[model samples]
Target chain A: MTIFTNFFYSFMASLFFALLFNAPKRSLPVTAAIAGIGYVVFILITQNLGSKPLGFFLATLIMGLLCEIAARVLKMTTTTFVTIAVIPLVPGLGIYRTMQFIVQNNYEAAVQIGIPTLLAAGTIALAIAISTFAVKLFLHFWQQ
Target chain B: MLNEQEINKIIKIVKLEAQIILENGGETYRVEDTVMRICRSFGLIDVEPVVIPTGMFITISHDNLATHTIIKRVRRRTVNLSKIDAANLISRQLTTGRISLDEAIIQLEQIIGDKSKPKILTATASALSAGFFTLLFNGSLFDFFIAALCGAVIQLFSFLLQGEDMSNFIISLTGGIFTAVIAITATQIFNMGNMDLIISGAIMPLLPGLAMTNAIRDTIQGDLVSGVARGTEAIIVAIAIAVGVGVVLKTLILMGGGLN
Candidate 1:
């Protein structure tokens, strides 16, 4: 599929999730747009560079930074945007597949899929944390 | 110049605000920070809050004396980002002196009483998200419809089971089973949609994405206890979902039904 198609799918996915999570109604468009862009970036990086972790890290970092900015500008907690934005890249499929392999008694396939999945999850988390911390540091320096 | 009753009121206000945030998917560290800020705004120094996923313990002292501690056991948690945002805004306004204690209480009560999202909205949101997710995962149009149906079924089932006092594990496990069953039945009967895509897409709504993200956020902010607690919660929910899906898949296999 084209990048635009991917972006559309990602946008719709995030939009409805924002609704499900009961995010502030007004912020739905902004949150979904950011999540869509982030997921597309992940797909592009992963496809071109052949590094899933790098893709996850970069995508989340960008998403996290944008979300923190949006939160501050919108006067909401960072969690509101960050949580919704990360939903698209949360590796749910990997977790599901790993469990599928495990239940099939396919340990080798399970481990093969599981390790990367866990690593990707970790990378996404670390990137988000870094982005959050970076924003805090920037605010601190501005205050000083 | 604060009297005993006023101090008591401040303590109550802080506790209520923290409870709202925690119960509505605010991170533990955010809860702690907001609690401390509110207490400080009320001229209560020496505040310490220990917040885990399930409960909170907070102590606030005035002038290094006259300590008040409150323990709140949070038994139910759902993902409502709006509530967290509202609580955060209220606390910010309180700290900035833009809203008085009584005003804050009124606002917090409004949040507590606010039940705006109906069941149909949630079910629809689940359907759309699952359907779009299937498309993202390269599922065909047929699979999208099947996944959407499964999503709605899972959401309705979960809503039906909401007041049963079941654990998160059981709820998610049941949700997963429902998703797999619906996806499998729909795909197998029609033999049009991709079962794998439908199952994965439908299960997306049930995954513990928020828990895992919050766990990492909590840990990075030095809330090790909450971090560990939420991390374990995430793992448990994930495993429960896996088991739920696995059980259905295993049953289908035993019955010699082709999952393909």
Candidate 2:
């Protein structure tokens, strides 16, 4: 029940973003599906490992690869789906809360919160970098 | 058709396509690479292209002792993946000799001329995404509906104000203020839903995901100029959203709004 609800809402979020990004209409369903998978991977990893950043990195990595594969199969640029599907894992809430802490003059608590926020953002970057490199490597080998 | 006039035209075509891609939030390296590849396909060597967050520069140095250069100052950037996709298709076709230069220009013009979805549809998209993101964060159904309302309003407001010369920082700041005002009011009056989840969901779509990814990708590829530009943009955007929400929450707390 929990997982189903998570999947449903994530799909909705992705659909909205896909529309806003002006993605081709035909790829909306695929974007939603990929978003669902991304959230699921994040949940499973975070639940098992209790590390939010690690979960984020792994989820983004999976989503990036899936987006590339989908784009290839669909003959579309990978950007459209990747941006939308990855939306569910971004640490927007964390950043907001960190700011709230600072505004309240709670410096120590802010740092505690801010570290994780930055880490989450960093992990997202790292994941994109890794997946991009992997894709290039895969193509280079495949072509040769 | 491989004359000086045609080469000059091809240079313009490649620059325009690259500019469109960059203007639509494409990665900087991808922009440079795409332009380079297209020029290479035309047998034009020494093609130089430089791209940043706000503008682009490209110069095609050919054997005819004539150089064609373009300077495009992009005033805005949005998350239009469709533009990038269309540009890619054209570049691929041109490189593979499946399309002629003039045909590719026509195709690009068609892509550029394509109209965005109707305002009503985009606003609905904002509403649905915001509401659903709240649900994903474990908000109640009541919260979901209210979030949808807040999201829709934000979207419509932003779209309506798209031509007012408003910067992103200001747009998100206003978005955050409005989102918090609605979320807090609903949570208090109706006595339902989590305020945090609702506000975050409404703000999620406004976050700079494209900028963040492009920054990372460019930094990894050693394109420090593009990387830093996009990174600064992402950071500034994040701070704007955070400050907007923080200011509202602080004000509310001071006004006797309690967490109980």
Best by lDDT: 1
Per-prediction TM-score, chain A only?
0.96, 0.95
Considering the two chains of model 1, state its CAPRI-style docking category. Answer: medium
**Which structure among the candidates has the greatest TM-score?**
1
Clashing pairs in 2: none
Cα RMSD for candidates in order: 1.5, 1.6
* DockQ list for all candidates: 0.79, 0.77
Expressed as tens digits, the lDDT of each residue in A1-144 for candidate 1 is 999999999999999989988999878998999999999999999999998888999999999999998988888888888888888888778887887787777899999999998898888888989999999999999999
Give the lDDT of residue A24 in candidate 2: 79
Residue range B1-260, candidate 2, lDDT tens digits: 26887886797688779877987778888888899999898888788888877788888887756777888888777678878988998899999999989899888888777766588888888888888888888888898898899888888778766745556778888888888889999999998789888988888998888888888889999999889999999988888888888888989879987643
Best by DockQ: 1
User: Which runs in model 1 stand beyond 4 Å of their true positions?
Assistant: none
